[model samples]
Target: MDSALDYKMVFDALVVPAAVLTPDFVIVAVNEAFLAVMGRTRADVLGHLAFTAFPDNPHAPNDPAAHGMQVLRASLQRVVATGERNALPLQRYDVETPGRPGVFKERYWSAVDTPVLGPDGEVKLIIHTVEEVTDFLHQLRRYGEREVDDTRTALEAVTTNVYARAHELHDLNERLKRTAGQQRQTMAALKEAIERQRRFVFDASHDLRNPITGLLTELEVALSEPSTDTHEILSKLLRDAERLNEIVADLLELARMDTATPGDAAELIDLGRFVVEELERRPLTAAVHTRTDPQVMVRASRIRLARLLGNLVANAERHTTTTIEIIVTTDPPDAVLEVIDDGPGIALADREKIFERLRRLDDARRKDPGGSGLGLPIAREIARVYGGHLYAADHPTGARFVLRLPLAT
Candidate 1:
């Protein structure tokens, strides 16, 4: 048999507010946690009927059916009768203050009661554990009330302010007219921005898809036929990969320029020498001709100028079979560079629209599957950044792409 002192020590060691009760709901033992929570000494509750010691508050409303004592009694009885644990949701329970006896303090608690069975499988005792939730419940109620009060105050202020202005009809009409005008302007600008973003996404996806598709297809075929001449197959795959890399790089450059303002440092570059040098860098099967003014010089970003010139020249070379002609001339405040090719010239209706992102001719697509359709658009964007312009015109036999930039002061 366990000693009474040992049982008391075990009960006092429990951390949760727990008590052991007999089958008739008399308190047998209470832990230190229960003593602290209930604000009572062991002598006050020991061997006392549970409901008798902490009965429903005498000052509480006379509604026995809704009382805390009734609810607690029902839960404890259910646990003992069914031989199963029972849990009670948070409920109000007033406890007598320790020092000021007979004064009950308001509290809320969440409780659970479990049956302890003996050797004969009968309930020997009931273990009841409780956790206090009074402070938390009160804080939550206060917070909700504060929010409602704030909302009501704001609504009242708005109502009063609006009613006070009801007499100023003419002034209100004028202000509303101005506000409507401003809204129209804002909507127009927003619409334009949205359209630009839409086009950018569509063209970027379309331009990037081709090379990526080719790269995947090539890799798949190469992997499937291991016994074939892998060296040749790898060379083709390498070219496709390089093409994808170039398209990605161009797309990134376009994205950066879209957010960039255009004040890069400008330098005076000799137009004739610049044209000749740039042409020499290209690997071309078509013959090249140059007609340049010796004194032509432009003040611009050399990198942008180079990219614009390279794109125009490359477009002419790739799209046409005729000899390429490079021309540089001065027009007082501006310098001009022209790249002419004996390819089919752009249609009159499509000339302006061709500068749009992803605008490509059917023949061009057939001739160059690797083209990202970004070259011309990017070239024109670079021209605009340098305060210049690029446009295509009808050549006698082919196409003429002209570039104009501010001349060096």
Candidate 2:
């Protein structure tokens, strides 16, 4: 099977706006619809980073988090990091005007980024697709405005006829009251949407602030010292950038988990096989061993389950240096998986606290400042979504993390 040919055929065939980007986010190919959306030719974007070609509105040049740039970057970075599809919220992304080279026009989009895994099972390309919702949103705004105008006109007519007839005026008053009630409901819904958007921005900004500030501080210090070591400065800059990337990826996953519902689609995943595959894909210093009942299976979202398992193993790797054990078994109606590490274990007091969002031990923070403090919380959320629970218990040698899920028929 020629993956390159298949990629080309699929890329050219899709009518929906789409582009193919390298793992580093360089645009290598785009379909006509995507080109139309950006108002640019292949020659202009083919070799450039996706963000470089269509930057966020210049009004926010200094504040990438204020615009949708961070959200979009986070979505693409997640696909690259975790090899999972990610959807961005409806964003007010602006694109270059057709004839105006540097000028941008306001647009709204519902965007998604999906990973294209290579034969080696690593993410090689990311397919970015977006649906332009600008016109639809404009239509909605117009409809709302028209309703307000009609309400005003009706109110004026009623006021003019207020002295004409008492019964008629009473009927008009009742109708107006009902209209007001409906408008209030609409306003409430709109307010809720605004609040959600505000919360999303606040969370993103809060998580992004630290790394960015650190990056700037490091650069400033480096610049102040004329004899500063360029190599050392670059090394610290790279680490800070990587830290920012990790935080963004975790936030994206956390957002996904927050919106995941019990009604989400499920698949029958073999516990033993899945555990082995996940372990094989990750790089760890600890020697890993597994014990499993090959027959055990669970009906759950494969991505979510993989995420849960991956987080447990990753947490173990961060804390332990010697050996890791992964065991899978079944107890009648439930399948159980446990990860045990041979390292300093968590205190009994902090076992449950570790699963809370952004909660990390002082020791763990000292060990790894780049940790987003979201992995355990996200893993537990995924477990609950699939009618399961994840917890850490005291181990004689080290920490023991366990995941339990309903067995598939």
Candidate 3:
């Protein structure tokens, strides 16, 4: 009999959700029960760090008691250090919905972490087991109502035992109060969820309407005017279709960014050199000048960084009169990159508003009717994810957009 096979069989046979992790918290393997409970597949989590695979919900409350990842990390660390099993208290850890980007389902869990020790008495691997308690918690909240009915029945039957009935009544009052509070919290959470969904639908539909309407109008005109040149009609249809495609692409990108977890694969990039290469690769209608400091370097994903730069440059091209300037410099612990244009500058009041989803100023609409209005938002999100910021700063001549990122250590 193969011992390894026997071990695997026993591990999979367990009825509860269980996963095996390395000492460094990397998910080495997960059982069927774990996959079912976590709403994930093996490919989604295997070989990834535990925290990275299941990140803490960014929308969760700021209370420490609601932070499941923090508690779980501490428990795992303790088990590794002491080489003993540890049971965690009830935790409210939400999980992302399977196949739905940017959607999370509320969840509660009761978990235990046990360490496997080697011959030398050091921790080898950690076995993490969890039981979902979300339903149970909901049921507990409803217990007060059920208890009240039973108490009323008892009070009627035990009229002679006044003292006993009085104590029962007092306890029931406390339970009812707690249940009322719980119900209020649940209602608040539901309201917030609905509002978020409503905003998302509205934003997507609002931007999509223009391109769809234009496409339909073009098709109708082509049908009504048979003498119109075939080449011109096809060109108009193609342009409308491309606009629709770009809007859809940008929406999908934003959704992905909303649910993305911080990655550990960042590399040090030379900001000045990177900017020069990106400009040379892309064709620009306006002349672009560069004032780069070679000493400015930052740690980031190359692809995402390039996208951020591209968005800034594209935005500048849309509004610049003739020339745009790209400046790279360092501000102590941060690397600063600024994109300045020679056209009309952004008003102080509209600086923040421009970053809102699908928000377009009057001038912007007049300049680029086909624009999706998502480029600046996407660029800002990327900057935020990298522990940086993108903002419009006061400039003497035109709109100046600045990006600041932590310098590479």
Candidate 4:
């Protein structure tokens, strides 16, 4: 059993009201104690700007003491600027009555804001902790009015002790919660890495099995038959060997793409001109036409982008009857490129399936027996790595593969 410390559990267990905020003062999270004290739910406070969530009482906007938001903001800013803790004095911050719009209740609090510094010694987050002292203040005021000086003094002493203890407890809880959130994120990433490794192994073994078995069977046949045609046998063996090499090459390319980081060997290219030049450099198997807009420009690794385009065009050529159309244009923020072929149109259900690694439709298998199914998947991955998208969109009479890339500024 995994005995991981559940930081969320510790955070929720905190009895003192506490919340986590970004350096910009946006509420990132709030503990259960904070929710209970504020009469709020997590959904009501999380992701909201701190001041926006707990605005000053509009009914008492002109009252200097009632501007609790200003006090809190000043304290928070002090912590951020100094990278130190800022303890606020007793504050009169009123809260709107839950389920009663426009009705605010008078409240007082003793609060502290502490900065969580990053490696660069800059404030990354602030831990805000508060203890409500409204009831105690009211009682103390009553005692003073009744001339019970001794009792009022005793109550003030107790309140001081309580506030100090609450501050210590809340700071500890906040630290635990932060550590737990980071651990959870790390575990999630590790799990994803493991899953990818597992899938890669499974795919490699499954695809390699057929070619290896065929090669062994062919060798056995050549040995057993004394009069077997040497030239024909060698030719067939060479084709099988080449097919094996292609699959391995495709697999390696996919693995390389999986680990590749962006901006490696990247360059700015005019989309239309690049497409025209690439097509001219490569021999075509079908009649290819282009309607490219020279104004469309993008930043990408030239080699990877060329491979992506080649994969799309090659896929189209394999299934095309006679013609292939390539279109490059701009759609505001994106540079759009479409490779359309006058072939059997892909069914809606199979459109997404084609992009899956080693996934080939029945027609695709019949068209090119030597084809490695990694082409489309690699193309899509390349597009994704460069903050782009490649998908099979609906076509009137054939398959339409569209690539949308963010246009370079």
> What are the TM-scores, per candidate, against the unseen true structure?
0.55, 0.48, 0.53, 0.59
lDDT of 2 at 29: 88
Q: Give the TM-score of candidate 1.
A: 0.55
Q: Candidate 1, residues 251-336: lDDT per residue as tens digits?
A: 87788779885556778899899888877887776788999999787777777777888888778888678688889998878899
Alpha-carbon deviation at 290 in model 1, angstroms: 1.1
lDDT of predicted model 4: 0.86
Model 2 clash pairs are none
Candidate 2 lDDT, 1-409, residue by residue in tens: 6545675667677889998899999999899888888787899899999888877666545432225666678778767876878766556677767778778776767778899999988999898998987786565556655777656555545433432343344346546656987999999999998886686577568768988998999899898997999999999899889989988888877777677574557998999999998888888777899999988999898877887888898888888868899999998788999999988998989999898677789978988776877889889988888889999987899989989999989
Q: Which model scores highest in lDDT?
A: 4
Error of 1 at 250 (Å): 1.1
**Local distance difference test, per candidate?**
0.79, 0.80, 0.85, 0.86
Using lDDT as the yardstick, the better of models 3 and 4 is 4
lDDT tens digits by residue: candidate 3, 1-409: 6545677778888899999999999999999999998889999999999999987767677633356677678779878976878776666677778789879887777788999999999999999999987776555445644677656544444432432443355356546656987999999999987886687679779888987898898889889999888898889889888889998988888888888854546788999999999999999999999999986889888888998999999999999999999999999889999999999999999999999878889999999987878999999998998899999999999999999999987
- For 1-409, candidate 4 gives per-residue lDDT tens digits of 7689897888889998999999899999899999988888888899999999988767666544456688788878878877988776566677779899878787878888989999999999999999988988677667765887767777667655554565456456556656887999999999998987787678768778777787888889999996999888888888889889988988888878877684468889899999999999999999999999887989999998999999999999999999999999999799999999999989999889898888888898899966768899999999998899999999998999999999999
